[model samples]
Target: GDDMAILAALGLQSYRFSIEWARIEPEDGVFSQAALDHYQRCIDACLSRGLAPVLTYHHFTLPLWLARQGGMTSPEFPDRFARFCEHATRHLRGFDIACTINELNLPLFIREPLMARMTSEKALARIAAAEAVLHGSINSFFLYSPREVILNQGLAAHAKGRDAIKSVRSEIQVGVTFAVQDEQAEPGAEALRDQRREDFYGVCLDAVKGDDFIGVQTYSRVVSKRDGSSGPEEGHPRTVMGYEDRPQALAATCRFVWERTATPIIVTENGWAGDDDRRRAAFVPEALSELHDAIAEGVDVRGYFYWSLLDNYEWAAGYGPKFGLIGVDRATQQRRIKPSAVLLGDIARANALGADNRSAAAPQVMGDGAPVGL
Candidate 1:
């Protein structure tokens, strides 16, 4: 239903969208030719209009086969996933820009939704009661709340993402990408250190430990530490949902990665979710400023892509979080550019003029922690 004409109108040169696995391959190895044809048309349409297609092979969802076959936990997952990547990359060869994986961290939750899904009747009763409080208005941001808690068993997710990259490296200009909420450990709190917030983050980066490029997805920041305290306790003051106005922290994180890795980095996803145009505009500039500082300080930062071409389904949050430059009416799929989207268009134009030219340097933080063997 999406012609993506709004993006062309907004003057965006490149945009990233995922090839929904479920849509393409509803069954195991039984892909729909119609889906392939539709996708081909989509790709050709983008190229025809001078828009770069950064095709994502997988987002959070997967073919029911994979989910049925033990999902990522299956021993056969690596081989099957690699084969899938090989086929996808070969099929979409010569796309303008390319991404191998979507939000890598997100798969962590999708593979295990039960961690958050409440089964008790009492809980269901409470949810019904809570909805009654809204007086028929949908709590659009429901999934983002703590109740929908999906834990990332960091190492497992990282391994899957890494496997995806290695699978297609020989066939495509592939990169590893993940959605990251810039979580910070609360300063002066030993518990923050104990909770291993940094460890969890490091795992995401580790997924692409030795890749051609790394895609960093920035949405909000959440300072998550295991809260064992009784009530209303604060350990490390990480950003509330990963957006704590901490440009310095963002810069430091990038700098840390720069100091360590040899891979070129891309800001694959960075945006604010709000109704305020001014704040949203400020958000992009600030994140870019931090990125600029990281590059200047010797990070091989390559390109920056905003979180979306347009606001669509916010996953469990539905249509609530407006992380798009072109706002979407979920009901109508009509698109209009927010001021921030305009700012991005200007930046994209400038960058296209400049091209992706950068220098190479050895990482400064390459081995802060001893390397782990995969």
Candidate 2:
């Protein structure tokens, strides 16, 4: 209730939040009406404030019961997810946009089994402790690799979930979001970069080609070298996540995805992880300027929802990183709106960037005819 009020106060007309699968269904076939009712109240609250609700059906966490049964690797996973979607969508009245899954490509990059096998016992113990604190009662320890299993199962689940939603209420626009990085090739390593991009994100993009839209969740650019190293260029201004503060990365990423899928795009998540609100304030307009350039060049971008509205708990990093427009006092539960929140709110109200916030010049055209700049 307070969160919706804060969003309305920020002049935000749309809100994007996730619904945890574990909360909706604790057991295989058991559906919780109480959970559905709770989400309905949340939707109603958003509508009351003239805010359009964008709901993501699944985030990262899975019910402990389901996880024990092999989770995404289980043959029954996709169908079970579809059944849940059908039940949940029946209670949702005004949600226009829905995402079937959040960051389906994440598993390919962060292989938990491989990490656990490689890291020392001490480090693994620390990680286990952290997971315990982060997930509370949920036992999130997985001994096997669901990486390849999920890539295939996730697509099936997305398709089934989309069908399930449409079966119940045909008007909801459904798609899946991917964690995209603007990847560039070092001189003479173009093929390596292409292969890496395909390995990481190509399958997901190909799967969503026929969906209503594709959510581009980009934060930084990665350069692939001939020697197989990849990361942000040396000495660039870095975010708290150690990502390069390259606002122009968004434009290039949008273009790359649009060219391949030809699907309409919506920036699902884009924000910096830092304590400096001034840097965040500056980053927003600059990144928006690059997004504007992409739109000007004819990319069908539907909307931009900032990564977050408040400083909430991040998965592994916990609550240490501040990526919110409004700061939270954990002890007192107080909300303090930062200057960046006001700046973003004003931009939202205006529906366009102010003249001063525009990019300094036209993007520089690369050798391959791609325009790159902020």
Candidate 3:
């Protein structure tokens, strides 16, 4: 497909993708050999393209067979997850780096209010219907499940899943990725900011201490004010997702995650969703420059991958977010390589930053919204 070719054209060394559990095991205890073979071919494709295949075991999309049996709340949750891992490891070959799960600590509660307003009556009714179908219990997916249950079940799943992968292929480097933000404390808001950071990243960061690496997915900088409200700074440009255009956030999160866990880091996801390709081109270099600073300061930062290679469907937001380096012609499915892709490709090919990128990535009062080097 042109998708893999587009990424290779961007001179990227690796491509990270998650195998769909539902596609592999649509029914309970049912394994699809065809699906496994398909994924093996995908791995081979990446390898053939000279791109390393980085695999993620899970990415929020839980198999309905498991969800119907009480989702992550079921006592068999961890064991079931381990079973899938064992089969995947044994059948799917060719990825040395993998993530047990992606963004296990997402703050879904904050979006419920907005979703309620945006949701149609039919959608709300479907929720009621699903609950009734589950016998008046939690029928919602694990993403919408109770936070405590997610935390507990999540920890267990990672432990068992990691062991399952290692038991089958001891050489595979395994870890979990977390959605982290650059948590900034406004004047008199230090304690509140610390608490916010703890609520979002503390548990997951602490759990992956012994793993080979921890993946950090940071996009924007968030400020915690004394008034208990947090958001982007007033004057900065914002992404379509309403996040501030602060590329320095990547560096801040890298430092935050490394200082806490001391584990090796890989930036699994970091990019904004917006229509401004120019901003994205500028954003990429600045963010990577910030990340390079962290590496120079003794952080064991290994690699980084942009959020996506194509403008694909963004969960909950659909296909609106243009976070891709290659734009897709909707009707024709033709690929349009944006300037950002060329810029990144040149950087990748040279293994060095150009003078223009270096000048553009210079610090500009970005640190904590005050004057400091990014």
Score candidate 1 by TM-score against the native: 0.72
TM-score of each: 0.72, 0.89, 0.90
Worst-scoring 10-residue span by lDDT in model 1: 365-374
Q: RMSDs, each prediction?
A: 9.1, 6.1, 5.5
lDDT for 373 in candidate 2 is 10
Whole-model lDDT values for every prediction: 0.54, 0.77, 0.77
Q: Give the clash count for model 3.
A: 0
lDDT digits (tens) for residues 212-330 of candidate 2? 99988888999888788888888878988889998888888889899999999878888887999999899888888888888888787777777778886887779988888888899
**What does candidate 1's lDDT look like per residue over 287-317, in tens digits?**
6666666777768866666665566567667
Off by over 4 Å in 3: 108-123, 129-138, 141-144, 356-374
Q: Which stretches in model 2 have alpha-carbon errors above 4 Å?
A: 112-118, 123-143, 356-374
Q: What's model 2's lDDT at 273?
A: 79
Tens-digit per-residue lDDT, 52-113, candidate 3: 78888888777777877887778798899899998999999888988888887774325356
Clashes, model 2: 0
